[model samples]
Target: MKRTLVWLGGMATVTALLVASTGAANAISRGNMPAYCRGEVSAMYATKPMYVKTGKIVKARDGSLSIQGTVDKGSEGIKAFACRFDKKGNFIDVMAMTSDGE
Candidate 1:
């Protein structure tokens, strides 16, 4: 009976450990999901034929991507603005804080 009790205790401990580990992994997976924002930003630029001065990606955390830079228009001065990307690597919204408003 003592051996049986020991075996049962060991099994319960192992089961608890497995459950805790699984939960930890799940939490990690949901921690940060902005791993694909760069690709999405590149796609947006490639699809358009406009001349963008090339912006640097700023805040890219927790699925939020922010880029602040300039856009070039021939015969006109460079326009600066900020672009934001959502979690799914899609264009959440683009804000033109300067001459070029998107």
Candidate 2:
């Protein structure tokens, strides 16, 4: 009975650890691109501790992807930008989106 209890406890611990790790993995994988683009845009443009809100991901016919988002610079106002990435998820360029929707 004691050995059985010990085995059950070990299994429970393993299950808990697996659950925690899975959650972490999902969070990282799901938000990897958006988070990465946000960080890059924030660092490149934000002058005074700005806020970055990530938007949808746009795919081009050329197999490239672009992460669209807005950067809020408080007093400096807000601006829209897109972080472009290659097919393999490589950094391409960051462009400021115009009001007319470029």
Candidate 3:
């Protein structure tokens, strides 16, 4: 009985650690997004029904922002899009989109 309890306690500790680590990783992922980008993300959501599945925000060569993400759902059936922004985070244009890799 004592051994079983110890094993169960160890399992619980491991599970809690896993959950905490996952939360931290998620927080780190979007930690770098500029404040203005939040508005753009919200605006994109307003005009459609979808969620960003995965994405990255990077600084462009001209000191702008380049955002690429996979969408869950929208009217155009677009699977992914590359959204561009000026240095100040103003929406520039969607440079490209891909329904499939090919």
Candidate that scores best on TM-score: 2
Worst 10 residues of 3 by lDDT: 24-33
Candidate 1 residue-wise lDDT, 8-51, digit = tens? 99999999999888672222122122222333333444433244
Q: What lDDT does model 3 reach?
A: 0.59
lDDT of each: 0.51, 0.75, 0.59
Ranking by TM-score: 2, 3, 1
Which parts of model 1 are misplaced by more than 4 Å?
Answer: 1-50, 60-62, 100-102
TM-score of each: 0.40, 0.60, 0.42
Which candidate achieves the best lDDT against the true structure? 2
Error of 2 at 55 (Å): 0.9
Q: Tens-digit lDDT track for model 2 on 34-60?
A: 887788887877553248888887789
Candidate 3 backbone collisions, by pair: none
Residues 1-102, model 3: lDDT tens digits: 999999999999999999888672222223445333434553664533235543668886888777776555466564566666667655666543664444
